[model samples]
Target: MAGVGLVHQGRTRQYEVKVTAYVLFSCFVAAMGGLLFGYDLGITGGVTSMDPFLIKFFPSVYKQMKLEKAHENGPYCRFNNELLTLFTSSLYLAALVASLFASNTTRILGRKTSMFLGGLFFLVGALLNGFAVNVAMLIIGRLLLGFGVGYSNQSVPVYLSEMAPPNIRGALNMGFQMMITIGIFFANLINYLTAAQENGWRYSLGMGAVPALLLCIASLFLGDTPNSMIERGEYGRAKIILHKIRGTQDVDDEFQDLIDVIEVARQVAHPWRNITQPKYRPQLTLCSFIPFFQQLTGINVIMFYAPVLFQSLGFGDDASLMSAVIAVAVNVMATMVSILSVDKFGRRVLFLEGGTQMLLCQVAVGTLIALKFGVKGEGSFTKSEADLLLLFICLFVAAFAWSWGPLSWLVPSEICPLEVRSAGQSINVAVNMLFTFGIAQVFLPMLCYLKFGLFFFFAGFLVMMTIFVALLLPETKNVPIEEMNSVWNSHWFWTKFVPQEVVSDHSSSNCKPSP
Candidate 1:
């Protein structure tokens, strides 16, 4: 279909572009931001479990840990200190606040600028965390890291979606999540290698700087997307970059579509307010709900506390960390499955299948834990039982990696129109951060009280979200970004909310440009 133009229903000729090396390079650079985020996610749990790190920053927790080893406390209550949890959750609280401001920054300064600034902030934060000698310094460093994550998470997915060819957009956008899984695997591997060394926690936390530096230097050389260029009124530069990325000069049809969309976007003085209008209800709902549901999958709590959870399950320190490494390795491999088949299999199929797989795994794991350690948490798992538990947990992680992990970021970024794209993505990031913060803060306490019931709670949410996807989410495979509104206009439930005339006018204007 590329290199040949075809007129559809008397509208302007439609042109498809080939993926060029420049586009791949730009996407790879942008996805480095996710590596920074995922490293932080994986490193914090391992660092918290280290004896030296706990003795230095959380002496109370270290005392509790020692007492639990002597069988003086319940296994569920060993690491339930509020201050210890704060060390991990504070970053997400900061990220939630920063994401709101990042929306405007991504819109005004462009996606590349936001990414560059994010790298600088992450660089500083990583250094501060590496050298921190007290709890205050460590929390401050975490806050800075949160600001960096907020900015990058808001922009990178949008940049990837805008730059990728329509046919491969889902696969390209998933590069961000693929990087996240790889980062988690690397962090867990590093933690396993460094756990026996002196000041090993510092090494695990500080390695985040490597990806930050890479993203910073790479973003400077990469050109902004054509959509972003047009949004900023850089018409000449937009066409030049479009031709270069598309690998052809016959980009007039796609170029004109971008211009027409920007003209409509320019008329709206307040994008935030515009997103709240009734017609945008579907977009707003997806932005708010998808991230919320993704967190309820319990993936973060597992990723954030894998080492601690394994320790509480009666694994020795070295064994616990090794289990975490294996689990994260499974996560990385499963995410590769998503990148290879997302566009081919489509989003909804992955969502439904993965949700069912995760649901079964969660219920099985819960039953195993409940049978091994009853309500009082006084029992321990046998060797065979512990291995079976690990197997189920790995299965759950693999299911999520191929489904919700990547789609959560991809769908929200691609669904929103240009006018509300930044704001929609900001909302997505904000909701994600908010839920992540809440879960991080409460997980330890919930573990203390709820015991084995927590997984069932998450499984209940998984059921509801799977049904939501099947009924509400339409197929978006191979749809051009500029024509996404047509998806809502045709969907059974969403069509009533979206005005047909508005959709028609927008499509016609994009297809048949003005004289």
Candidate 2:
């Protein structure tokens, strides 16, 4: 199964050099997409308060413009329930549509260009939203903005993963996911501070422009993946870029390594179709479900609906908004822990540890919420009751942030071989975003309808997720992409699990790396 033969050399000075400093510098610049994602999702929580502020603070303008009716459905507007929900969830609606096209768009435009397009949409959408006078106009801005986010969410990781070295792959790839949490933390903090001010929602919406401009500027200097360059047959160009990316003066050796990988792809005859052949079966299974099940566990539900969930706890605006900010902070901090542990502890351990921890936290939160609403009754909570409920929910969010939040993005990038990295990453991302849209859209209504029981439902799903991770996922901490086929073809998979005949060793060497 060592088709190209194992090239292991233990730890060397090469590992100490921080090869990705410049590459990750570029990564940091491109990660503006995540900031936009976090800001847009979390901004709505603060934006909802705008209707009340407009009604009370901007009364003459509110009445003159019919903005007062906008809050009729909630505190801001009771007049239009559909419009209110649309205003609240329009990003998800656009994200769902964008997910359908994002992969194809990235394929045609290439990663860097795709990200640039996303930035353009974000910029226009932010301006439109800042100036929107009606619900229809806000929806248009959100739809355009979500298109950019959907594209970024799908393309950025593949780009980063393809560029990252194997040993630190999880750390770098997870950084993209980590930026998302940081974006949320930053967004929520901005909103919390601004929520009581006049026209604060406009400021919050317009804040998206900050990251959009940075992304647009950053894309200009960024390098496309070596895989992309290889696929396009720009080998000499890929070599030069890889030198700059790795920050090495030695281009000759690196060029040969890339060429070696590309040659493997050439022998496979059809790299994409080989994913279904017995040898590539492990990668196929990991690619499809690693991401889909990540969503099935219901992380997005919490992210998209944290405010509503806090409101259900009988907290007032100040308490709920403050708690949401804390939750975002917890998410950011916990992900940092994962970043520190992922390389040392390995992927399988992180998932097992994080998933099980998350399951327990969900169960406790579920029980607490159920007991609070069902046993204590919903009219008003005792001081202690409110505190306990808040503590439990915070713990639940912390658990998710540490475990699924970053690792879900990290594992998929590492598991697929170089031959199928981009396409496989695209598939995984498409599944994640598609489910993210569906789940984010329904979570609020499901909670409104299901009430406290929603926690228990999610808790059950969390357990299922924990079990699947324990039973199926391989530890990929040090496994190089070229060696993945060995594990994929093992008898453990061949006899006991997947029953397909493994692709012979002779054929494995032929699956070339790009360009």
Candidate 3:
């Protein structure tokens, strides 16, 4: 905004610029946190099914049933159903609680530094989980994993939001979530490859350490976010970082803006309460509610329990696990669509369309499940119905992957002002994990009790979600970070849904344009 020429009435070579290595590399390392997050989510269903894992942790169940063969299927194999639920949801509980203190962590340590610490803990947790001998040990491992996830979840997106140029910000941030899908696919592939071995679960769980280590080491090369440096009154370092990230020596005006904004914080006397002030309240409200609905979309439930969900849909154990793999793979492919289209389509359109599609898929899944299970009874899926179920599930997976999965992380990351961004992102991510905890804790049970009806709950939530997006969600496609507040304050219908550039209203000009 300083030396950068933001206004362009026509296409130019400069306007079609490519991303720099520094931004790309920084996001790459930072997004490894997401990779580990996905790895943890995916490995659970596969690892829990591992015979050696069960025999090691639930010896009582193993001995009580007098089971001898590894492939044997019986009640003994199902001994730790509730315990597995605890294992799956424990990290989110830790994430929800840890986020309260994350603001302090990010402020003191710096964003990249916070991620480094997160990666360290993730490594610790992954190793512990890999070697766990009891339920308590496994739970402890998940707690550490949850803490690491909260730290990185809070840091990475905001870090990317700060560093990336606004023109491709949505696509870049969406790519961060795409890395998550890759992690899920990688974990599923590992599980599928090793689900047959006696002690393969250990290998599958331990593989999480590879990305953790990569993140920890790669993050060391990355600099602190320009926002974080500016917050600490490191003007010299902040200017240098801006120049390096913005790829221009003429960043003085942008640097001056940072100084001025921080001075505003000083004048406030209570900067911690700044976000709750009327001026910032709407965006804060957006930050708070977005995460609630994001989880209510039930993406986590599907990600965490795809194998189990497929099993209930009448697939055999091996087939169910394979179906979960296909589901994750589809998720990755769909996220690619988002990564390419988000900046082009604008945020508001995708949010509305994707939410509606997900709602429809939920209805279809519920209806088919009701028809198959309610009318015909359980374990009675016709081949035609089974094919349709998988089709609908993949479509649902695609719907979430392209729309909610990436946007959930992106919008909230950039929605807050820089002064409160660390805390804001942390709070939103914490809310995400909190809802994820409850939903996940309830998901398996609902599948058991509600059977086909579990989807209606998701659909019901989506109805509200779709309307909210259409009415309230702001289009932030190419808006610069400094101008996010102005975006939130813009008019309700006519201008907000359309990017400020395309709209005739000049009132939204408060935001600094990206060159």
Q: Which candidate is the best by TM-score?
A: 1
Give the distance in Å from residue 334's predicted Cα in candidate 3 to where it truly belongs.
0.9
Instruction: Estimate the TM-score of every prediction.
Output: 0.96, 0.84, 0.88
Better of 1 and 3 by TM-score: 1
TM-score of 2: 0.84
Ranking by TM-score: 1, 3, 2
Q: Which residue pairs collide, candidate 1?
A: none
For residues 1-515, what per-residue lDDT tens digits would candidate 2 score against the true structure? Answer: 01112232221112212355778787776667777887787777556545554464335533633542243222211122344455656776576567557655665456787788888888889888888787667889988888878778777777777676666667777787688888888777777777787777778888888888889888988888776677568887787777777666554544555566666665665445766776556667777787777786666655665654565456676777787888888888888888778888887777777677767767776676666566323445677887776676667667677677777776776666666665666667667766766666566556555656666777777777778777777666755554444444343543354433332233333333322
For residue 463, give model 2's deviation from the true position in Å.
1.0
Prediction 2 global C-alpha lDDT: 0.66
Question: Whole-model Cα lDDT per candidate?
Answer: 0.89, 0.66, 0.76
Estimate, for each residue in 280-396, the C-alpha lDDT of model 3 and write its tens digit: 665677778888998998777568877656654567768878888998999999999999999899888888888998999899988987776673233367777888888888998
Model 3 spans > 4 angstroms off: 1-18, 58-80, 268-272, 375-377, 493-515
Best by lDDT: 1
